[model samples]
Target: MNLLFLTFTFPLIGWLLLSFSRGKWSENLSALIGVGSVGLSALTTAFLIYQFNVNPPEGGVYTQVLWQWMSVDGFAPSFTLYLDGLSLTMLGVVTGVGFLIHLFASWYMRGEDGYSRFFSYTNLFITSMLFLVLGDNLLFLYFGWEGVGLCSYLLIGFYYSNRNNGNAALKAFIVTRIGDVFMAIGLFLLFQHLGTLNIQELMVLAPQKLVAGDTWLWWATLMLLGGAVGKSAQLPLQTWLADAMAGPTPVSALIHAATMVTAGVYLIARTHGLFLLTPEILELVGIVGAVTLVLAGFAALVQTDIKRILAYSTMSQIGYMFLALGVGAWDAAIFHLMTHAFFKALLFLASGAVIVACHHEQNIFKMGGLWKKLPLAYASFIVGGAALAALPFVTAGFYSKDEILWEAFASGHTGLLYAGLVGAFMTSLYTFRLIFIAFHGEAKTEAHAGHGISHWLPLGVLIVLSTFIGALISPPLAGVLPESFGHAGGEAKHSLELSSGLIAIAGIALAAVLFLGKRRFVSAVANSGPGKLLSAWWFAAWGFDWLYDKIFVQPYLLITRLLGNDPINSSIGLIPRLVRLGNSLMSRTETGNLRWYSASVAGGAVLLLALLLILN
Candidate 1:
């Protein structure tokens, strides 16, 4: 129990050592400190898990208050850590998957500039993510939330020599900041009405204070959903994620798999009680997820950049999680979150190896016939891709995603259920499309697979986890979250699972038909008029960036251009301008005209005398 705090401490110590070294340390030394710290954190988590299971805490909830912040009118939010089944599951994902990503990064970032600096940012990212999932109160959680945002900006722009990387970093920072503001407002609303930011206390108090669908409660939930949508890259806020791949492949894996993108799912699940009070907002959550999954799925189909396809896939998968959350399948949502961390991290790392092998060639159309050269990478992709496509009972994604779809169907959210089905098909199609095109076609470039132990070890481990073994490890959420309507639909559950599985298999078959040996048919269609239009549209992510430029960015640039001279400052300067004008006119009276001055004095004296006589 006492060791729970060590999870955060180890990562902090790593960041401090790497950061203070200022890139003076040797690569091996820097990697030791960086990877060792997260390794220690992962070890601590394992021990804590053992302790937690062997000796369960009272009510399966353990709260460790480190200290009080300040006292004011019955408001003293302490720096506390909360652990339960839900947090424990999230903790495992952050530290366990985080350690793997860090390990792989040490290999992936070899010979790169600012290697120590990269480790520093990644270590700090792990620390922030730990705090995000473990914090006991909303205030503490927000503290971690902002920290994760800052670390992402730093890591995404790690290759700052490129102007576009910096822009990508800044874009991610600003877009997520919009969501942070809404989350902050939501926290304030919760505190104002409930008088506490402690998550457990709020859960107990909210039902007592506000009835179902109370206006204040509804707005609070709505504000929280706004935060979730932005952070998770749903709908309008999703544009930053694809560009975010401008960073290192490890950063992409960290963001997409382990850290920044999953924060929203954790936030919503943590505050499930509040969302439950507002069914309308809850329904909106499902609707947002459904729309985002369908849109991102189509966009992924046409993306040629390997990393961008995975980026869109992350968005779509998270959309499924959100849809699960909206339909009241809390456990199912988190179950998929865990499984996703396993397979998605594997895909990114495997893609990183491929990218490095082909001399950093990222365009899928440019690479081919490397399956024999990079056997490990090819195998990694097959396992990870199968899991991603949720290929029936053999992969981790199948069990978790199947649970989500079944819950949606059982909950009577037929629209959401169908959306999940479509997303499943698209996921399989694009995943295999990348796999077949990149690994099986005519060779277009020379390749050398990464051979070091650091490079292959992480991939080997993640490849195993992406299989059915990973799916068997269910999170201990029996009492932590609301139970899904599991096993209630009887034979219908079997039918839905079988249908989703077959749909996924069909997508793979179609991808093979279209992308494999696709010199003629697919190319011909892509060149045709309507095909060109649709391909271009999907390639640009359905023109969200263009639409946003027209609606927001262009107008904003125009407004700034019009105000380039500081018109507000000029308007406020009017008072001083008028005063200066008066002073200029008054100065003329003192302009060395003695006769005029004497006449003015005589007029002033005569007026005073008349006033005095009238008063008398």
Candidate 2:
């Protein structure tokens, strides 16, 4: 047996079991099934990774075809598994990080009202993401892509009783759907021109078949980028992720932190060949990434809610990955993705512990002096923050980001490099802002509870992985990618790395001074006119939500109210009204009156005879 399907199959089994077991089975058993399915999948995937390393596939690719999906008029795609370095990276991240998050959730959701439901949704989420990366063809990938979107809606709205959460979920679904439509159009165009939707074939033939500067290729790739933008929460499609904190913290860590938000990067990486066919769209990817990262970083700065800060942070980090992809630094992008998953998940999970300890209080300003009470979580957060800050050679983020910065510099994208540097500064400042406020001040609220192995273990593991995993994995990860990956710069590499490292350090130092040491400077800046305006703008996500409401939403609602019912729908109502009139007229003519009936028949006969006379 190929055994790849087992990754999704086991999780599907668990999700189904947990779905029905709610209120019918013991909580402990439910927890086991929920966690065990993903755990087993993780283990199996690890074995597969080991096997892949030991005997790498020929041409660094493997495909397992389950069956032919369609053959009408020779348009055939299949239920196939496209296993390669890229899919392998995603699989490891999804299964591995997902399993850990599930473990953490087992503790986090303990004694909650819908614990089983949470696990069921979480399991299904993992299954969907797996299918997304594992699929062999564009159509199959779209199935998984839509699957994750549905799962995001369900999980984000897991607390259906809360109206805000429900709204947030709906917002996510509707916004992402915009990108999905563009992607569908793109796929249709590609299939229409190329006559195939197979991933491998597209990768092999796209560059050759599609000439340079082809308008069709540019439009098609741009459309695909739309889908990536929506799913990954880049730029205009990014307004939903912060509100998505309406869901559980585990979901924040699992879906938003590690996997779902990175879907855009993965899509671009997987289809790099197609993107290469249109450098215009490729440059746009770089530009979008640069702008989004900076925007999200600004949004993260003034956030009061700890989870929302992480939410913004996730968006910003994915922006970095996008930047890397745009610069033709594919390996650098994936490296950052893996490292970001580890640290970001660690941050969110550790935040969960803080929330649980503080009686679910999420305001970092209200939290104070947790250094003693939540020592493990405190340390774990420090590790996550350090990695997030990319503290030189000590953390995984440093190496991953160093590669991107050098690549950006080498590719002559100095403006994007500058943007990356600025984004890094803001990332550090926001991260440490929460840290200093939450852990340094006197305790404003008491945290009396301390968690055991279930909480601390996952946090500890993620903390360790966040610091070391990227460096260890980068070498082999590079090999698995395309030939363009991991190219070394002559002498600029060292200088570039040093400059980026100092920029990161400077960001940390500035945060320490402003937030930790000198508070009055911050107050002075806040009172300034420009500062106030910028703060208000960034806090409102650059007012995209407000602009969208005015431009798109209000008009829609007004139109609906005016035309949604009765008179507006009278076009449809016309048929029934006309039918009633015809029935009434016929009935009136037939009202037990043979004279009226004979006159009507005579008129008809006269008309027929007149027509015959005219013809003769």
Candidate 3:
């Protein structure tokens, strides 16, 4: 009945309706339900935002306890909803932009055999992500976390008949589970120390209750970071996201770019109180995030598959968000998360348009001069790509990314700032590299012959949003926190303000020269020493996956074989051989049937008689 309840319930209702009517509902009706549900939820979120502005909650925190969900010995985990500026931002992104993506997907996935199924998964993903951001307690957050993971696996493997899709889904789920194990342990430790999973209560009590620099606290924080790293696709755990491109492009737009992948950054931001108490862990997070950002950016550069490049870019961009969080730029990180959801989703969906128009061809080399055939997609791609490259003032990427880099610089983490800069330069190179190679060059293949009004419409909508959303968030986000939290301030400084703007321009210019202006020269260089290395660096993602394969996968397989064959079989075989030998020795006594039986019986009687005589 409450607005928050409506915010959570409507999409679920749509999910149920579509699920029940999967066989009966027409594709158009199904699409409407799928998109409409999230749209209504977004509307509800807008209403809540308005209501919150009219009467802000105490200390910017809002709580609505629905019920006591469960209780154990001296422990209670309640089912409750929380609304704060943080949650409000996430709600808008998840439900609002999510609504737009769903609308796009309706057209994108129109004639697919699993139309209703895809929408069902999308709705479920939205519900889970909403619950994740809005939940008042850690238990429910974990519930939502697992829910999204399940949904990701399902959606990623949507085309289950394909072996590669199934494998990618499995890899994603399994790899993330490794991080979840650490997260679960961390959660238990938190409960043990604090005796509650309520996030607000934790925030209030954690600083006082937790001893600063405590080893156990550091361990717990690090463990939690592992989960965040996996969910957000940071180092060592980032491979799954790049591989997840095997899924449908819309799925990539929703999960990788917009909703699911950001969960890690959200978790760290939500638990800032806890992380702030553990500086060592925070530094570790920053270092890991920096490494991942640079690494993934390079990976994105050489990827020929349109979706794979975007996938790596998503990982790399999330690394920036993590870097912000790691360096105490919590608000900045979340701000990036919001802005990223807009433009990255736009990018992925636009790329999907290209793929669709190209008759499902994804190789950038196979595409050229598509700007004329799909002008809307080209515009959206450019907008998204510019934002990704963090081109100067007013772009969504510029505002959010510049804020992150500024925070990193101010945080006194010079190494992180440098890595971020390098990543920025590379981001521009690869983004425009794709743009030039795919859209600007001479037609490499026949123009995709099919044109539909439905296709271009979504691209146009996303392009408008990508270009404008950055400015809307700047003022409010700058003022979201109090001075005591160390965030009160002068206007948030953009890294690309003036000097930084020139630096950004230089990077863009370099990309233009290499990828667009001097393609033949660049191509020749790509075949040369340093350029070959750079290309290879991008192609193999600096051999991170190969190193992992050698160090972890091969060793694991070897151990598996050893355990399965040698040690286990040898142990089992020893017992079986001993049993066989004993049987063989005993079988000799049973030879010749009746004669042997009589001799044995007589021998036993004589022995018993002799013993009795001796005792007497």
Best candidate, TM-score = 1
For lDDT, candidate 1 versus 3, the one ahead is: 1
lDDT of each: 0.93, 0.87, 0.82
Q: Report the error of model 3 at residue 163, Å.
A: 1.6
The digit string of per-residue lDDT tens for model 1 on 1-616 reads 9888899999999999999998999999999999999999999999888988999899998888888977899999888999999999999999999999999999999999999999999999999999899999998998899999999999889899999999999999999999989988999999999999999888899999999999999988888888888889997789999999999999999999988899999999999989888999999999898899999999999999999999999999999999999999999999999999999999999999999999999999899998999999999999999999999999999999999999999999999999999999999999999999999989999999888888989999999899999998979888888776765767889999999999999999999999898558889999999999999999999999899889999999998988887968888999999999999999988878889989999999999999999999
Q: Write the per-residue lDDT of candidate 3 for residues 484-555, one digit (tens) a residue.
A: 122433444432355455666677787778777447887888889998888887788778778888999899
What residue pairs are clashing in model 2?
none
State TM-scores per candidate.
Answer: 0.93, 0.92, 0.89
Pitting candidate 1 against candidate 2, the one with the higher TM-score is 1
RMSD of 2: 3.7
Cα RMSD, model 1: 3.3
**Which ten-residue region of model 2 has the weakest summed lDDT?**
477-486
Misplaced by over 4 Å in model 2 are 475-480, 484-486, 565-568, 574-616
lDDT of 1: 0.93
Q: Residue 549 in model 2: shift from native, Å?
A: 0.9
What shift in Å separates residue 31 of candidate 3 from its native position after superposition?
1.6
